[model samples]
Target chain A: MPKILIVDDDPNIRQYLAALFEDHGYLTVVARDVAEALQTAQDERPDLITLDLDLPGEWGPRFYRALSQEPELKSTPIIVISAMPGSRYAIGNAVASFTKPFDREELLKTVGETLDL
Target chain B: MAKTVLLLEADSSHADALKIYLGRKQAEVHVAATDEKARGLLASRDFDILLGNPYGFGEACPGEVKRHKLANPLLQVIIFCPRALMDQAMDDFGPLAANYLDLPLNSKALGLALDHAEKCIATEKKLAAYSQRLSDLHDAQSLYQQLFNEVPCYITVQNKDLRITDTNAKFKRDFGHEVGGFCYEIYKHRSSPCPECPVAKTFYDGGSHGTEEVVTSKAGKQYNVITQTAPIKDENGQITQVMEMSTNITQIRQLQDHLSSLGLMLGSMSHGIKGMLTALDGSIYQLETGLQKEDRTRMAAACEQIKEMTERIKKMVLDILYYAKSRELQYALTDVRELAETVVSMISPQARHKGINLVTELEKDLGIIEMDPNWMQAALINFLDNAVDACLFDPKEKEHRVVFRVSPRDPETVCFVIEDNGTGMDRQTRETLFTLFFSSKGSQGTGLGLFIANHVVQQHGGSITIRSELGEGSRFEVCLPRVKTDHARLNAVPQPHQNVAF
Candidate 1:
């Protein structure tokens, strides 16, 4: 099973995504902010990352730049998830983008392709 | 035109001869044989020339001629007497009489005398018309001077050098500067002319120009003014000076600042709303799955999150509504204890969730207080909510506590005190907490909480005192007058108006 990292500031979003990924036979790890997101991404080395654009302190793109600078995690696919409508183009190299309350089936299809499953 | 002559001669033959001589010169002569008859003729009619012999009236003729000349300065008088009385006539009449002549008049002499008198009449008529015009010019000048002094706006006439040459009464009253003062120095207290001067623009283009400016008065008060400049031209149509008139618009700009900030506040608030809505969706998703799997833990947690999110949304909506409308307090007699209790209840659950102890001490009977109940409760809630947030943000390992105390300070005052044993403000934050535009989201979490809270307290005729120690705790005491404010009395009926942001 491929592992996924959930990065969001909201606890409820983290809980819901964790439960959904686990039930779908995928391993899941969660981080509350940019600092935690970077630490967990390095420690767990998840197969994929679902990134939220807005956070309490640093934005998600800043975390993406930091992650890409790491030689080992440079190629890890990133899926952009955000409530901001115009955030799709914020990270030019994003694998895919999904707005909040995105359709579960479509998100799953995009996630499946990104992981090559 | 023909000149009219009054002839006074005792010799009828000589008078007839004079009439024939005067007629050839286009003069209509009226003959009066006696002095009384001549006086009657002079009183009854207007004559351009008076030709008479002074000896016939016995010294009365010269005096009468002088009196008539004084009454009508434009009338010409000619005295005809024998060479014996010519000197006396000349002395008595002097410049009053136009010409003097000999009696037993030679045809050439009489003809020459009439011609001289007629010439004097024409010159006097021309002088009279010129003098009438001169008086009319004086009246017009005074009328324009009155208009220049009475206009309401601050008007100044500036020359090419931007020096104030003249000012209206209003300008002198407000600026109180001398006429030769520099326009910049008088209006703006600046050493040099302003970069975007409307007066200068008018001088350059010879067309009216308008601009808005913030100027300082002589009393050091600032005024927002809309200035308009028009070129003051000379008789040859050359622009000599520019007349600048400024109307004070401080009140209008102040109102606009309030409204403009309101517009800006709404745009920033939408981001917070979006985040909350996304969390709401997450909660709904959990609720749906909890019902599907029959998981008691998921259902309970989902319900709690939903309740908290909804409560926050409801509060934010109320805050928006409060700020959106015009700031007219709807005063009512409210139970003071109830109002305090309601605020505490709303805040206690948050304190509990954050692992902070919440305590309340209220007088048994706080009595009924006159205030806007809704605004009063919102203000108290903000203070208490800040206390809980302070406790949550504290890095100390020691226990945290928040105490809300309500009591009557006097017969006319009720007080509310919120104290927290949590992170306290530094020296800078303490000094500038109540200062307007004191926004730095460090000590006060929304940055607007304390600002709006202070405003609410002041609106209710109240004061707020803050005490805090860094790394220890903070306390806020709000003392409000128990009776309605004078603002409420004057605004018994609120006038509806467009509201703006500050």
Candidate 2:
């Protein structure tokens, strides 16, 4: 099964995405903060990562740096989710970008199409 | 205003001599040689002091002195007696006599007693007048309170510390249940005092101030209150208390909001439509020119753009109609979970295109919340739109998502929480979020979304709250009561409003 990693401080969002990915026949790992996301990346070596630009403590560039340094997860596709559609970080150098309250089908399609599912 | 002295001595020789001496000292002196004659004279005039001999006709004359006192209670009576009779007179007359002179009165002692008697008389007269005036003032104060309490405005008195000292009848009736409560707690519905208080300024300056403020009741209903506070002062010009009159202006504020919103709606619709028309016209011109030149590709593109612009205009018109009638919410019993799902589904496509997650956690077997589905959808869409706007940025944050969760809070109410992991609002933005005509989006915002949402929620006996922190994200919570309101019945005939996603 394809492995997907979800990073978000909100437990509800993290749990919901995990359930969504698991239901769709994928192995899902959820991380509530940036530190946890880095640890999960090292251990699980997920196929793709979904990252929230806003994590609890170490947010924005700090989390991005942590993700870029992981040798095992360096080649893995990362999708950035943001509420601000016009923000500088929404789509800069990310594999895929989505706005909050995203369309479920399009998100799945992007993930499926990106991985050639 | 001339000082006068009346000597009531029955001894003819003593009376004549005393009269000559007092007259020489610039005092008008009248001598009566008999007690009966003196009593008759006293009945008709105002006297500064009355000098009398207690041994009138040698009849153990205590009765005559007492009678004189009864006639004029404030009369200063100085007894003149020979040294032999001085002790007897004092014992018999009690102390009604202010002082005594023995034998042949020394002119110096007599003159001093007369001056003392004049001062005593003046003080007594002034005190009597003052007492009468005070009684009259009390009557006037009671009458004024009656008039003040009868007015409709809420009146309250507070100390410099904002402690409620007293409240009038109207204030009592309006907020009597909250007596002895902190002024801010009772009036502003705040857990603590307001940060910026006009009452504080008024206290500092000893001046009157008027301002409009929003106050919340214990029941959580908000009121637009116009308050005026004036300093209550003492004779020394020190502010002892503050008199506050607050008038409920909630309805007036709502009307002003409605009118301004109506104006904004007209203004934006005209502006949007005009721009849409101009674009449509330009596209038409392009298509006509392309067709004339036999360029089929350009003509097709122009036609497509025109169609899109027209569709956009149509949507704008529908939004205006939806909000214009939001005051009258027609509602019915609707499944809360189903409604949330439907809204999520409708907005999912836009989210999917933007690559954001759309999710809903609807509790199963939840009872229905009565609300106007079309209006409610418009209101919810406002939150969804804000959520969408918060996440619409260049770097697609992977965890950018909005969640619509509904759970039964109680048998009579359902909790609907729509939280977005979008850019959360700051304190100031949250404060003015739902106020009519207050928008932070500048020209891009019509300021109608939250206002309309607030109105719709209020109509359905529900409440909407926004929780946000800067750079983190924002959450919108709406709690709807399960009991069907009259508004629900009116809106229940749901012909889906045009452009309403849910």
Candidate 3:
């Protein structure tokens, strides 16, 4: 099964995305902010990661830069999810961008295509 | 100097004798043997003196003297008459007669009278010149007065101590006619001189300076004036006073403010609208996917999401509408205690969701107040919402609570107090809390909530005040009069671009 990482500040949004991916036969791990996302990415080495731009403390773009520096996680695909418009440029290596409240099927499809499901 | 004289004598011997005697004294004499000839000579040239024999001319001598005096008021007349008629001729001519000499033909007396007549003529010419000069000076003084009073600007002369030494008619009528009053006291009602005052600068540098200031009249009317100040120096070149000239520019400032406010409204609303559209897109995606899968439960969830998002969009649209709409207020009598309870109940659900307690301590006898219910409710809700948001944003590990209290502040005023033990604002945020488009909450706030709330309170002829310190809490007090008056409504109408404080 493909393992996925969800990074969002809102608990409801994180839970909903996790359930959507788990229902598609993928193992999902959730992180509330940039710090938790970085810790989870290093530990789980997920196939794909969903990032939210507006986070507490360090933001999603800063986390993306730090995550890109990690040699083991450099190849992992990142899908940008934000409430901010035109936030696709937040991460240069983002596979796709989704604005909240995001399209459930579109997000699932993007994740599947990124992980080659 | 040769003096010109008109001699009216019916006897040629007497005329020739006087003429020969006057000729030796450098006199140019014209002798008329008849009354008609004397009238003809008087009309032909301006004579310095008229030496006439009234006995020869009969009763017409007084009439001729009156005519000549009317033509040239400075023309001196000497009437040679019998001693019995001397008093009568003097009475008829009044001040026009220089002398009434008895006609005995004494050459020495005649010579003395001629010299006296010449002296009178010289004095009359000097008096006429002095009268003309005086009238000219009067005209110049009147023109100066008109320029000072009727120039359509406020003019004030202040001494070195900032006391108003003099003011023009326009300044007296618009401000007050109080001389020897402090300029700041009369102009702005301030106890001290304003900081960096233009008048003070002119006095310091002895140069002209200009600045824009808001001046208030004695009756509390405000005016935006562009004021220029210049020094009034003494004869020794020492600055003794400063002259302040101000032109009112309230209307132009109002137009500029209105335009900028419209721009601010447009710029601030764009982000929230974009977020709402994206949320609507999400709901549509859910509906389409649920329909494709043919799942009843998923379709029901999608319908609920659509309904929820639609409500949010409607609220956002109404918020914008409320900020932009300028409408007449509809006032009704309302109970203060009941109003406080209703506001607390309305916001209690959100407070409970965040594990925060919402409490109300309303006085029993708050009484009924005349106000617009809709606007008052909106303002109260905004305060409650802000209190809740402050709590939600606090990262402290403690329980949050908000108190809504209503009490009578005085005989005439009723106050609504909202206190929250949440994340308090710093001084900078508190200072600009009521200004347009100033928001502390990024993305989540439209920055119009408090501004509109303050507007609603002012519309009701009330005031709002805020007290906050960092990490402590915030207290908002809205004081309103118990009885509404027409004067209050008239005074409360928001002026365009006026920076209104609670």
Best by DockQ: 1
Against the unseen true structure, what C-alpha lDDT does each candidate score? 0.80, 0.71, 0.80
Across B198-241, the per-residue lDDT of candidate 3 in tens digits comes to 88999899989999999987667678999999898989999999
Rank by TM-score, highest first.
3, 1, 2
Candidate 2: RMSD over Cα atoms?
14.4
Q: List-wise, what DockQ does each model earn?
A: 0.37, 0.02, 0.23
User: Which consecutive 10 residues in model 3 chain A have the weakest lDDT in total?
Assistant: A10-19
Chain A TM-score of candidate 2 vs. true chain A: 0.89
Ranking by lDDT: 1, 3, 2
Candidate 2 on B108-161: residue-level lDDT in tens? 887788888878888988999998899899888989888778767778888878
At residue B425, give the lDDT of candidate 1. Answer: 79
In TM-score terms, candidate 1 sits at 0.68
lDDT per residue (tens digit) for residues B1-502 in model 1: 3888888887888889888877887878899888888889989999888787857765676677789889988777778889998888888888887778877667787677778777777887888799899999999989888888888788999899999999988888889959999999988888988998888888888989998998887766678999999998999999999999999887778667656756765765565566567677767877888999998898888898898779777876766666655566778999998898899888888889768999999988799899999888888998888788667656577889999999999999999999998878788878887653343332112344566677788778788999998888899999998898674454332333655333
Off by over 4 Å in 1: A1-3, A11-29, A101-116, B1-12, B16-47, B53-73, B78-152, B158-210, B215-223, B230-242, B248-267, B329-346, B356-502
DockQ of 2: 0.02
Per-residue lDDT of candidate 1, residues A1-117 (tens digit): 899999987666777788777767789999867888999999999999999887654688999999989999989999988776777798878899988756667877888888885
